[model samples]
Target: MPTYPLLAPPPLSSGSPSAHPPSIVTSLVPPMFNAQAEESPKNLILKKVMNELDRINNGMNKSITLNSPTINDLEDCCVKSALNCFQSKVLYLSVPDGKLKKLQIIISNELHKIVNRVSDCKPKELEKAQCKPCDSYKEVDSQTFVQNLKTLLQKIYASQP
Candidate 1:
């Protein structure tokens, strides 16, 4: 019967001075497997969702064209992008125990608050030189909506296994 070699080669003979140093042996061996290197599918999906959310947040931070767009117009853009993100990405994410669904509802409610606040103000009120809403909305504050969303997203990402 033929005998097979061991899975690992026998240790190098210590008597002879080796041409290759011990560092060379360490370098030749492949690095240990890292769980983080292979991100879960859910993690990848969440990353994409967060990226879209960041884009929306960044867009809101910049001052748009100075052509005097109505507050409603700006709010509408934010709302539409948010809804699109939920529909296209967040809804389909595979999260544990319906967490993604819960997040969706929260985001939707916040967007609605923004929409209602913008709509409540009469065009004339906005037209007046310096009258902005006192930033009061019972459901959600539009001014801090992006920050709140980011916080929620961070919590969700950290909860991932």
Candidate 2:
């Protein structure tokens, strides 16, 4: 059986000049953390959804712009694209470490919060800003954000086996 808490080089071949096996220094190596106990994707998403529901109770607390603006007026598409690209380029991402759903929820919540804010409504429960907020967001803009987020949520729901 192999030894524990101690190890040394095995004996050399018959012609080896050195008689002794190399001595190994004993040190307490810290136990490496392989991973954390992560929440299931569905549960995590549900928690966010439920939290938003609780916070709103009846309806939004922030003021929403009556009629959100047009593609040309409401928000700068260029800025959105630039930020998206910049973040993708700079963010440290790895498969095992990626919080994909959390990222999606945080971003989606921010956009929705922007809409509600103009309406004079309360931000969603998950409304805490985690990243740069969207600039020039308005209430009377195209309904793209709502539709896009709805579809994305649907896709996420359907994608899970």
Candidate 3:
């Protein structure tokens, strides 16, 4: 009687099974590849806002380091630059009416505080011949402002359809 030949399994070296050769079926199939989807308009806007905030933060740090002689000078330089950067970015962004109103209020409040602090630190001349003690510079809490902006951005992004 004639017998048919049988295929043998791959040899195993020690007790562990040997690695199997690449299968033609798997090779023919496409690799587990996924294309990255494009970001939504809201996401893009949020990213731009975050980037602008970063730029403002960096500018503040640079101004602080360079104008360290007087606390007033440091505060003036840093605050002015930060406000300018923020204002420019705000103007550039075209937020929806609902979010725009909220953003405007928050930004206005923060700016008011900054402006008041700056005014308070300004040197005033006395009418009399006597010199007066200068008011100490009040540090602006930008971290809180930035955090609030980030929270607002998150809300805006979430609310987007």
Candidate 4:
């Protein structure tokens, strides 16, 4: 009988340092939102929006980890596509543009709308995913984090304005 060669497992974390030939994935800085910090109410609203968006985004990350295909699967697709970099496919949807600043505001606003629609998930649904149940009374820091991010993003936008 002939023995098959053993295969190495994919990196457990995204962008691990051990990835040979260091991936060419460039670091991206999300564009700033507004020109003046004190002049815009957009910061506050955007902050509120980002808070909600972060929750859903983070939940999606957790869901993928719990139920979706792993990086190994993506690697197979990359090989089939003849793509050299896995990072490239991960970011293909985010082709950066000079107008990213404006686009972000619109996106953030839309995200806020979506977040509003889905902020509360049924307890049973969360349980089905093996996630901790949400507490109606417990404090969530997402609001503050989102607010800070928005302020920072606003500053970035202001620079372009």
Residue runs of model 2 more than 4 Å from their true location after superposition: 1-39, 50-57, 61-63, 66-150
Task: Report the candidate with higher lDDT, 2 versus 3.
Answer: 3
**Candidate 1 off by > 4 Å:** 1-31, 35-37, 61-143
Q: Which window of 10 residues has the lowest lDDT sum in candidate 4?
A: 80-89
Candidate 1: tens digits of C-alpha lDDT, residues 75-146: 422432333332333233333345444664554544344333322335564454333232222223322444
Per-residue alpha-carbon lDDT of candidate 2 for residues 14-111, written as tens digits (9 for 90 to 100):
63648646674545466667686675555356346444433332222222222222234312223233233222321221112235434534544543
RMSD of each: 15.5, 16.7, 16.6, 25.9
* Alpha carbon lDDT at 29, candidate 2: 60
Comparing 2 with 3 on TM-score, the higher-scoring candidate is: 3
Estimate the TM-score of every prediction.
0.34, 0.23, 0.32, 0.22
Report the alpha-carbon TM-score of model 4 versus the true structure.
Answer: 0.22
Q: After TM-score superposition, what is the CA distance of residue 82 in candidate 3 from its true location, in Å?
A: 18
Off by over 4 Å in 3: 1-22, 33-36, 61-143
Question: lDDT per residue, candidate 4, 4-75, as tens digits?
Answer: 233333454465747634343343446667885663444444454455445433432221111112222232
Candidate 1 has an lDDT of 0.41
Clashing pairs in 4: 32-156, 32-157, 33-153, 33-157, 34-157, 34-158, 35-158
Error of 2 at 97 (Å): 35
